[model samples]
Target: MSMVGNPVQVGRRPLDVDLIDRARAGDDHAFASLLGPIVASGYRLAGAMLHDRYAAEDVVQEASLKAWRSLRQLRAGAEMRPWFLGIVANECRSVRRTRWWSVLKFPDVESPAMPPDDPHTTFAELRRGIRRLRHRRRLMLVLHWYLDLPMAEIAVITRSSEDAVKSEVSRAMRQLRGLIGVEDA
Candidate 1:
């Protein structure tokens, strides 16, 4: 369980269901096993939201700890991935609110694997536009678009109505397009 590679193999085990259940019952190993698979996904989501490697790592770590501590409070039928993501998202917000991580914005130390170079300025503009969005709306858009999550699941993680998620996503998209100067085609 390196938590940094091979998502397929890491989370492929059917034991996750059992592990989640046991972890919810206070088993530490079960909790560790439960978190191993989705940790990378959590990192990816947090990384996208924060756009900083170290900050994303911090968010993931904090979210994992919180999820573990509160695992027992989760509903029985709820899936772990979204639960974990929600925690990570919250951690990202906490880190951003502190504003100490803004030092990561300099290009020299930033991760180079951002969006593709095609349409050259698209990614840069998109990043800027994303930053312009209110924090909650930005998270919703990133979780929906980058993570490819449906509105229903995003609603679950964001703790908002599906309609609200839909509206936020819609507004975010509209704002992005407006910023990019692209009219409906």
Candidate 2:
């Protein structure tokens, strides 16, 4: 889904703040409720980044499990979205590393047959091109463009300077544009 398609909530009420507070205090139900909104977004981010359903599912699952286990480690008043997404990105890197090791020993399988007119298939090609990028570049591109994360947060997540993040994003976008044949990717 595009950024325009996702709903935005403007302000939080007191109850919502209480829920976050309770969730941080090890309340399972509140944590579950807190996770509800992020689950689909997490899946989308992982799917777009990894370009494989199984890998994306595993990434999200691992991230979610880790988040549940370490909920209390999340400091009070911290923004949950970027923090959780950082976890997902970490899991994605793990999945990519394992896949890279496997691919060293075996070739990747061909795509299953799909109708020529399928837009989904076209999008899959774009995602495949993303997967072809180097790890840091791919992570930078996905987090910046696909997830609409700010450069500061991306730098924190990727453990780079904001200038380095900007440089990688620029380089990745150029490569992606060449692959996708567009001025913008």
Candidate 3:
């Protein structure tokens, strides 16, 4: 059964539960099936965090492998998206730690093109502002704003309290507004 494009309903769907069980039992296809829908989200999160397509791909690969190995540990009724995303976040953090020096180099050719338009320019500026934030703050902002994840889920992924996540997101937004030269009104 195809898992891609399927709604994430954890134990509510018999097929999803079956796939999870088979995946936990070491069925590689089942594992791949379960990951199909959410993997693109993982890639997007990694790309936003790392700011490099190739590095993001590497991070997603590492995270996917980790999820595969730890599939059995996942609770039956729990949502898989947040748990898997947390792994991706951890992998991104590890990559950032190891490749801290790489940030000094010129931008990658694969960087998204920012068209010379009012909205696009503003978005590009905002992206630049986001890249300037501390990594943890950036991750929190991207998870909440870019990925549309809930604050509680972000807290779980970052191992911070929900209040902490809320504060960090607020601080990041204020910093971003300053960087983009937008005055609070």
The candidate scoring highest on TM-score is 3
lDDT of 3 by residue, 66-131 (tens): 999998777756677777888999898888777564566676234366665668677678888888
CA error at residue 86 for candidate 2, angstroms: 0.6
Decoy 1 TM-score against native: 0.78
- lDDT of candidates 1 onward, in order: 0.76, 0.74, 0.81
Error of 1 at 61 (Å): 0.6
Model 2 steric clash pairs:
none
Instruction: Tell me the spans in candidate 2 whose CA falls farther than 4 Å from its real position.
Output: 1-18, 99-101, 104-125, 178-185
Stretches of model 3 off by over 4 angstroms after superposition = 1-16, 100-104, 107-117
User: Which candidate number has the best lDDT?
Assistant: 3
RMSD of each: 6.9, 7.0, 4.9
Better of 1 and 3 by lDDT: 3
Ranking of candidates on lDDT, top first: 3, 1, 2
Give the residue spans of candidate 1 off by over 4 A: 1-18, 99-118
| TM-score for each model | 0.78, 0.70, 0.81
